[model samples]
Target: MARKPTSPADEVLLAAARARSSTVTATQLERWRGAGLLPRNVTRSLGRGRGSTSAPADGVVDLVVWLAQHARPGRRPHDLALHAFGEGLAVPEPTVRAAWRASVQRVVLSGERDLPAPADGEDRTDWAWDVAERAAANAASVVLPRRMRRIDERLAAAGVSWAPSELTQYDRGPAGEEPVTARDFATFAAAGVLAGAPELTGPAMAPHVRALLPVGAVSPVASWLEYPDEPGRDPAEINDGAGLSLLPIGDVREDLLRVIDEAEPHQLRAAWRAAAEMREWALEHCGAVEAELDAGELGDATLAWMMGAILGLPRLLVRQALLDRRPSISTQVSTAVMVLWIGVSLHRLRRLMPDGQYELLPALLPPFLHPLAGIPLKPVGEAAADDAVG
Candidate 1:
């Protein structure tokens, strides 16, 4: 059967209707009409002017919902162009804006924006899916925040009630206490897991760090030739040069290389010295990457994420120090840090997705790492190696 052509007035009206109910523009309506997505007679013509044409009420609602579902990110859709037509149903700007926001919330914001729907009846599939996804994500987000806050409060209370500076002096850690070392990279690595991370202490810290001490060297500062000038030291010179050359893992050493790379000559030398000790430590411990990864004691993802986090700090710090007119540090330190971190992240990501596909990383990470975790569409945490490598 042959379909009748839509009148100009109905087209104009449909444009307004779509705009009010969904977010479709008049231009999109015209395109849909031309594409047979809408019935030809769905539009109406009221007057002589170009603005007189409009779309039907039913078509307007349907098209708006369709556009919202398929709208691409980073590009404005054709439906937005309908704001040009001022006549039709006299929908208020604020009301339409609110309705649009609501529609987006119902469709996309709830995270059910990717479900399939049949072309015929029942428009509630996507809408219902969105509500369910949003509810689940919301519940998780709410519960996690409360748990985190309670833990934090309990720790703070314990710290205030039984404050002890050192473990040797204190009997036991407070109830539900987190390691203080995690708050600082050097401390965390040295005290928790890294070999050279713990000894970066006191006024001697800066000087010893500048000297590039060995990762496992006990009393590294005393091993330096410059120590002879200090108060209680004998005139005996030390020669543990090899000990200072090897960087320990988890130290902020590569960050020094970046600083030297980026810093002006005036600050370059000092920043290099500052990184000496850390560099030596990182070189030794972190160098054995393959072995550590194989053991699974070191998570590739966690290491990579931490590397990024650590490097970002130095980038900002160097700039801030330079702005203070202190050119004693290298500006390029952040780059080295970032590269190492990225390497770690990529290594982990590769392991997580052995097949060189994102079927795992994208689906798994958000649910596990994001505050608002969701029920994954696929079993992301399942052993991926069997599927990809096997």
Candidate 2:
């Protein structure tokens, strides 16, 4: 049976409740109601069958205030909805979960679609836009796992647990930073190969060249190798004339340089495709990890590996950005932002885990710092000889 409509006096009553309980504004009440976080106001017709005035349901004022206190700034609507559901605010769990998942998926899809294509040249405007898009996408990617983890926390706090409709695992181990080491570099080189990246790998610099060349000299060689033909000059001539004794490793360097120069266009396209795939895969894996955590299927080891993978992605992206001489500025900025997000996430994750239980896997450390690929060590007396020559 339909209930009797409330009177205008009920609005005054709600106003009084709001005054006593919380400082929620009239606008907030309407928004909460529209969002289904609160029940709709009841309306009553005047005895003369004239117009009606609406008043909030009993206790809604206090509930709204309570939600306001818990609500954080900058939260997504779905996050707020889920929070309400977790707090037993009368919204259906399935409905809330579905809405939240759909909102997240939409954001992810938009980021993926909006990822800027490679710029034609040094088009600063286009490059800036691309960087902004990339940063936004990367930021989204970083936040996704944190969001999933928060869902688990919220449900656990509320003493609720539910399995998703589908369950599967996609094992792509930790994606981010690696320790500076030869073995780690090899691992990444292998991964690049498997990804069908161009044969950009080559032998490390000979020991004598590594020892004789100052770190500064070695740095430019790596960059130059990436675009040897850009100067329209022979890399060997450039190195030999510069007296770096790079001749011993000249053949290997030239081969790698040739691959980079000849295959640059393909490599750039490949990097974009690879980066996109990695982002998509990482997001999917986050969902899987969350589900596994709920089911008690995920252990510390697996969790650590997953965290490492997430952390590794930023490094990979940044490396690719740097490798492209005419890189999208957006990609560089986004990669940096992603690294920050990943670092924060990792710190939080570490706090939750047992001491020494989580260790980042040794993998693609930064090129400049990698023992094999990095600048060669200098002999103690070599600097004196070079200084004398200078």
Q: What lDDT tens digits, residue by residue, belong to model 1 across residues 249-365?
A: 232333333322443332322222333333333333233433444454544532432222222322222222323332221222332233333333344434433455544444323
Residue range with the least summed lDDT across 10 consecutive positions in model 1: 366-375
Mind giving the per-residue lDDT tens digits that candidate 2 earns over 178-204? 222333333333322222112222222
Q: What is the RMSD of candidate 1?
A: 24.7
Tell me the TM-score of each prediction against the true structure.
0.16, 0.25
Question: Which regions in candidate 2 have their CA more than 4 angstroms from the true location?
Answer: 1-20, 34-36, 43-62, 71-73, 91-98, 106-111, 114-390
lDDT of each: 0.33, 0.39
